[model samples]
Target: MKIEAHEVERRVETFKAAVQEAGLKLTHQRLEVFRELASSADHPDAHGIYDSVKHRLPTVSLDTVYRTLRTLSDLGLINMLGTAGESIRFDANTRKHHHFVCVNCGLVRDFENEELSALQVQEDLVGFGRVLETQIEVRGICNDCRNKS
Candidate 1:
């Protein structure tokens, strides 16, 4: 998606509001960390986030990244995912979407099939509660990785 600068600013404000709503203090470091996650197309892990921001913030610690990731995930600002025996990664997009994980490289990519969401679940399947989130994570080797093998 081609996000405009104005949109980025708007999102920043939205994030701040969310933080405030959660009774959290808005700090510069937190904003920077949250912005990176919100703006990134890649759903990177804590390590990836630390690596990306380390250049700008020489003194930023890994602990800060981990804490921010947890806070953001709790605030519904990002989605966190983890594969079997793999590190957790974050997705900035908050809209209902699914993911496709490349087992070969452990890369997580967004995959949306409208038909899946359009389908209705059986009443018996969810007897007591309503569906709040419907995210699917499919694991397989990516085409590029498969071709390389």
Candidate 2:
């Protein structure tokens, strides 16, 4: 998905509004972190985010990036993909969509399908209570990895 400039601006604005609604302090670091996430198509971890933000704000620390990401995740502004065993990843596309995780390089990419979105949960599966969310992660080698092999 090609994220346009206006779309990034819109997401950033929405993020700002959410921060205000959550009564969280709005800092330049937070905005920069959000912008970096908003503009990224690759699901990035805290370290990746820290690397990106540090290019613009050299004084920014990894801890600041983590805290900003935590605050945004807590506010429901972003989706935290904890299932990534190697490293926790974050998705800016909060919409209902699945993921394609490349097993070779651990790359995460978004995937969307009407049928997947329309799936109905059985609710009685293992007595896990009501299912509030559903996300499918298809693990396999990506085109790049396949070509390399």
Candidate 3:
């Protein structure tokens, strides 16, 4: 799921604005890191992003990539997925949407459903807690993986 060039540019602009607004310097490495994540839909992790960014920036360390990702996530410029015990994946799309996760291949795809979006958390689920957002993750085998088996 390749993002359009125009959308990528728009996201880059948003990223720059957000960085400046947060009083952070928009460095080359940070831009490259964001670009890599923005342009990708595969939901890459820190190591995956590091591998791609290292080609253009040979001096880039894995630690830098980790920190850059953390900063972007902290700034609400990106979304993080997966549980704490598992490897974390990053998604560039921050809009309201649900995910279809392939249990076999670990592929994650975004989808939008009005019904799902309108769902409300029941009081029984979170007694005194408030629900800020509701997102559903439907897990199943993807077509390719199902066919391969």
Please name the candidate that would achieve the greatest lDDT relative to the true structure: 3
Better of 2 and 3 by TM-score: 2
How much lDDT does candidate 3 score?
Answer: 0.88
- Encode model 3's per-residue lDDT on 9-102: one tens digit a residue: 9889988998899999999999999999888878889999999999999999998999889888988888899754568888787778899989
TM-score of 1: 0.78
The residue-by-residue lDDT of candidate 1 on 1-149, one tens digit each, is: 23357656777888888888889888878888877776665687899889878887888999989988898888787778766576788876665567787788876666678876565665455567776656677889988899999
Off by over 4 Å in 3: 123-125
Instruction: Kindly report which residue pairs in candidate 3 clash with one another.
Output: none
Q: By lDDT, is 2 or 3 better?
A: 3
Measured with C-alpha atoms, the lDDT of residue 134 in candidate 2 is 74
lDDT string for model 2 (52-147, tens) is: 889899998998899889878988989888763567788888778999988898878887898988888887767868788778889999899999
Model 1 CA lDDT for position 108: 67
CA RMSD (A), model 2: 1.8
How close is every model to the real structure, measured as TM-score?
A: 0.78, 0.89, 0.89
Candidate 2: where is the Cα deviation over 4 Å? Answer: none
Query: What global local distance difference test value does model 2 have?
Result: 0.85
- CA error at residue 16 for candidate 2, angstroms: 1.8
How far off is residue 51 in model 2, in Å?
A: 0.6
